[model samples]
Target: MSDQKASTRRIVVGVDGSGPSKAALQWAARQAELAGGVVEAVTAWEYPSFYGWGPAGFDFGDNAGAVLTQAIDEALGPDRRGEVRQVVVCGNPAAALLDASRGAELLVVGSRGHGGFTEALLGSVVQHVVQHAECPVVVIRGPAEATRG
Candidate 1:
């Protein structure tokens, strides 16, 4: 029973197809491997908010799924990729990560300004999750060092 309970621990990670997000995923995967827990890689996409400017026939869900898969593959590589679980949500990134991280042992995310002011420290999603996540959150900033020890 204790063993079952231990393995049930999940480390949730938010991936946004960004370099910082990939670093977050890598860090989360290493942490999960070290702690004997599972890694849940999550990504979110929102429907086009423009009233009539949406694309003709593009499926955002599919695109999101592809992005998540690619991120996992690139971050974890082939040897460790199969160990992490993947999830895609259709909504705001911050809300989706928070919802998915419920009951998780840890929530990991990235912090790099995707756009806007270049001097900003944290991205909007990372800032929101850091403030509001139910679990302890780890924010990866800048590029991950070469194989962190």
Candidate 2:
């Protein structure tokens, strides 16, 4: 029983179709491989609520799952892509990642995301996760040279 428990390890990573997020996923995958853990690559999406107009103004046409999948594919490449499991949800990115972190050995996210300000050191989502994640969190940052390591 102890051996079985030890063999089962999970790592949660957030993806947003950004360069940093892709790097984060790569980093998490590398870490998972080293630690013998499974990687849960998650991406969150939320439709804008258009008050009045009978909801016709709002567009739910965007497919968040496809974006996330493309990010994963681009990061991992054709080979070894199956090592990571893709997950898509509807909510705030930080909250989604935090929720997924439950029962996970680690939670990984990019230092900054797509909508983050260039001058900012850390994005709001990263800041939120760092403050509130239930498990240990890893923030992936820097250039490709540094991130790939």
Q: How many clashing pairs per prediction, in order? A: 0, 0
Q: What do the candidate models score in CA lDDT, each in turn?
A: 0.82, 0.79
Encode model 1's per-residue lDDT on 32-149: one tens digit a residue. 8888788889999987768367777878899999999998888888888336888899999999999988888999998765444553667688889999998899988745442222
- Model 2 per-residue lDDT tens digits across residues 16-119: 88778888899999899988888889999876574364455443325788888898888889887336877888888888988888878999998643332553
- Candidate 1 clashing pairs? none
TM-score for each predicted model, relative to the true structure: 0.83, 0.78
Best by lDDT: 1
How far is 36's C-alpha from truth in model 2 (Å)?
0.7
